[model samples]
Target chain A: SQKIEQNSEALNIQEGKTATLTCNYTNYSPAYLQWYRQDPGRGPVFLLLIRENEKEKRKERLKVTFDTTLKQSLFHITASQPADSATYLCALGHRDDKIIFGKGTRLHILP
Target chain B: DTAVSQTPKYLVTQMGNDKSIKCEQNLGHDTMYWYKQDSKKFLKIMFSYNNKELIINETVPNRFSPKSPDKAHLNLHINSLELGDSAVYFCASSQDLRAISYEQYFGPGTRLTVT
Candidate 1:
C-alpha cells in the first residue's frame, strides 16, 4: 500500500533553534513535494514546494530538501520562534492534480 | 476578500441524516478538491475536479458525492451519514491540473459531527 509518513507526531524546540521535520513516502513517484502549515481550527496554508528534480528549495527562513532516491523530504525552519509553531504537513503530487497528504508533524517552540 | 471559502463552519447532526458542504474559490483556478481530516488530523483527498469535471476519486464510500457546478465551486453531499463520517472537510483550489508547480489554497474547513 502507498504510504506517506511524517517521522514525528510532535516535535519541540527551544526558541532560536532550528527545527527539522521529516517526510518519507513509499510506492509513489511524485513530480512535486509540497509543505503546508495548519494552525488550530484553521485549514492548511501552502508553504513551499520542491520538484523531484530539484534537491532543495528555500523561502525566507524556511528550507525544504527533497531526496527522491531515498524517498524522503526534510523541512527546516531556521531561527524558529513561538510564532512559527504549528502543525506542518507534507504532500505528494503527480502531474495529474492528484495530491496525497501525510498525517503532519506538530511543532512546538518553547520560550 | 477571501480567496477560498466554505459555508457552515460547524455542523452537528444525528446519524442517517443528510448534509452538504459548499465551497467556492475566487482565484480563477481550474481545479477544485475535497479533503477529509479525521480527529487525528490526518488529511486524505477524497475527490478532485477540473473544469467542472471529476478527475480523481479515492476509495471513498458511495454515500459521499461531490459536485462541481463550475471550475471555481465544488460541493460535497453526504447521504446517510454515520458516526465514522465525522471529520473536518476542506475545499481547495489550484491554478490548473497540468501545472507541476501549482499549490493548493484551502478554505477554512467545515467541521461535521455525526452523533
Candidate 2:
C-alpha cells in the first residue's frame, strides 16, 4: 500500500536553533513534492516545492531537500522563532492534478 | 484582500442534515479543489475542478457532491451528514493545471461539526 509518513507528530526546538522535519513515502514516484505550513484554526499555506530533478530549494530562513532515491524529503528551519511554530505538511504530486498529503508534524519553538 | 475565501468559517449542525460550503477565489486561477482535513490532521483531496470541469474525484462517498459554477467558484454539498463528516473543509486554487504542479493558495477553511 502507498503511504506517506512524517517523522513525528510533534517536535520541540529552542528559539534561534535549527529544526529539521522529515517526510518519507513508499511506492510512489511523484514528479514534485510540496511543503505547507498550517497554523491553528487556519488553512495550510504553501511554503516550498522541490521537483524530482531538483535537489534543494530555499527561501529566506527555510530550506527543503528532496531525495527521490531515498523517497524522503527534509524540511529545515534555521534561526527558528516562536512565529515559526506551526504544523508542517508534506505533499506529493504527480503529472495529474491530485496530490497526496501526509499527516502534519507540529513544531513548537520554545522561547 | 483575500485571495481565496470560504463562507461560514464555523458550522455546527445535527446529523442527517444537509449543508453546503461555498468557496470563491479571486486569484484568476482556472483550477480549484476541495480538501478535507480530519482530526488526525491528514489532508485529503475530495474533488478538483478546472475551468468548471471536474478533473479529479477521489474515493469520496456519494453523499458528498462538488459543484463548480464557474472557474472562480467551487461549492461542496453534503447530504445526510454523519459524525465522520465532521472535519475542516478547505478550498484551494492554483494558476493552471498544465503547469509543473504549481503551489495552491488555500482559504481560511470551514470547520463542520456534526452532533
Candidate 3:
C-alpha cells in the first residue's frame, strides 16, 4: 500500500527563525506534490505545487523542494511569524488523478 | 467568493443514522473529490469525480456513497453511520483531472460526529 509520512511530532521554532518540514512517501511515484496550510477547524489552503521534474518551488517566504530519488519533499517557511503557526500537509497526485496526503506536521512559531 | 464550499459545517448525529454532506464549487473545475480526515489526523481520499463521472473510488466502505449531479456539485451520503464514521469530510476541486497541475482547492470541512 502507498503511504505518506511526515514527522508526527510538533515542530517548535522561534518567531524569526525558519521552520522546515519533511514529507516522505513509499510505494508510489507521483506526478506532482502539493503543500497546504491548515488551521484549526478550517480546511487546508493550497500553498504550492511542484512537479516531479522540478527541483524546487517558492512562493513569497515559503519554499518547497522535491527529491524523487529520496521519495521525500521538504517545506520551508523563512522568517516565520507566530501567525504562521499551523499544521502543514504534503500531498501527492498520481497520473490517474488520485491524491494521497501525509499525516501533516504541526508547526508552532513562538514569539 | 468561496471557490469551494460544503454545507452544514457541523453534524452531530447518533449511530445508524443516515446523513449527507453537500459540496459545491464555483471555480469551474472539472474534477471534484471527497476526503475524510480521521481522529488521528490522517487525511484519506474517499472518492473523486470528473465532469460528473466517477473517476476514482478508494477503499471506502459501501456505506459511503458519492453523488455528483453536475460538474460543480458532489455530495456524499453515508448510510447507517457508525461511531467509527466520526471525522471531518472535505470537498475539493481542480481544473482538470488529467492535468499535471493538480493543485486542489479545498472547501471548509464538515465535521461529523457519530455518537
Candidate 4:
C-alpha cells in the first residue's frame, strides 16, 4: 500500500528563524507533490507544488524542494512569524488525478 | 466573496440521525471533492466529482453518499450517522485535476458532532 508521512511531532521555531518540514513517501512515483497550510478551525489552503523534475520552487518567503530519488519533499519558511504558525500538509499527485495526503506537520512560531 | 463555501458550519445531532452537508464553489471549476478530518486531525479523501460525474470514491462507508447536481456543487449526505462520524468535513474544488495546475481551493469546513 502507498503511504505518505510527514513529521508527526509539532515543530517549534523562534520567530525570524527558518522552519523546515519534511514529507516522505513510499511505494509511489507521483508526478508532482503539493503543500498546503491549515489553520485551526479552517480548511487547508494550497501553498505550493513541486514537480518530479523540479529541484526547488519558491514563493515569497516559502520554498519547496522535491527529491524524487529519495521520495521526499522539503518545505521551508524563511523569517517565520507567529502568523505563519499552522499545520502544513503534503500531498502526492498521481497521473490519474488521485491526490493522497500526509497527516501534516504542525509548526509553531514562538515570539 | 468566498470561492468555496459550505453550509451549517456546525452540526450537532444524536447518533442514528441522518444529516447532510452542502458545498458550492464559485470558481467555475470542473472538479469538487469531499474530505473528512478526524479528531486526530488526519485528513482523507472521501469522494470526488468531475463535471458532475463520480470519478474518485475512496474506501468510505456506504452510509455516506455524495451528490453533484452541477459541476459547481457537491453535497454529502450521511445516513444513520454514528458516533464515529463526528469530525470535520471539508469541500474543495479545482479547475481540473489533470490540468497543468492542480491546486485545490477548500471551504471553511462543516464540523459534525454526533452525540
Strongest candidate by lDDT: 2
Model 4 per-residue lDDT tens digits across residues A3-111? 9999666999999999999999999999999999999999999999988889999999999999998899999999999999999999998777678889999999999
Which 10-residue window in model 4 chain B sums to the lowest lDDT? B95-104
Candidate 3, which segments miss by more than 4 Å at Cα?
none
DockQ each = 0.74, 0.77, 0.75, 0.67
For residue A78, model 4's alpha carbon misses the true position, in angstroms, by 0.8
Model 2, total clashes = 0
> How high is the lDDT of residue B47 in model 2?
92
TM-score of chain A of 4: 0.97
* Candidate 4 lDDT, B1-115, residue by residue in tens: 9999999899999999999999999999999999999988888999999899999999999999999999989999999999999999999999896672589999999999999
Model 1 lDDT tens row, B1-115? 9999999999999999999999999999998889999999989989989899888899999999999888888999999999999999999998887784698999999999999
List per-prediction Cα lDDT, in the order shown.
0.94, 0.95, 0.93, 0.93
> Per-residue lDDT of A1-111 in model 3, one digit per residue for the tens?
888899665999999999999999999999999999999999999999999999999999999999999999999999999999999999998786578889899999999
- Kept native contacts, as fractions per model, are 0.75, 0.76, 0.73, 0.61
Q: How close is every model to the real structure, measured as TM-score?
A: 0.97, 0.98, 0.97, 0.97
Q: What is the DockQ of candidate 2?
A: 0.77
lDDT (10s digit) by residue, model 2, range B60-109: 99999999999999999999999999999999999887773899999999
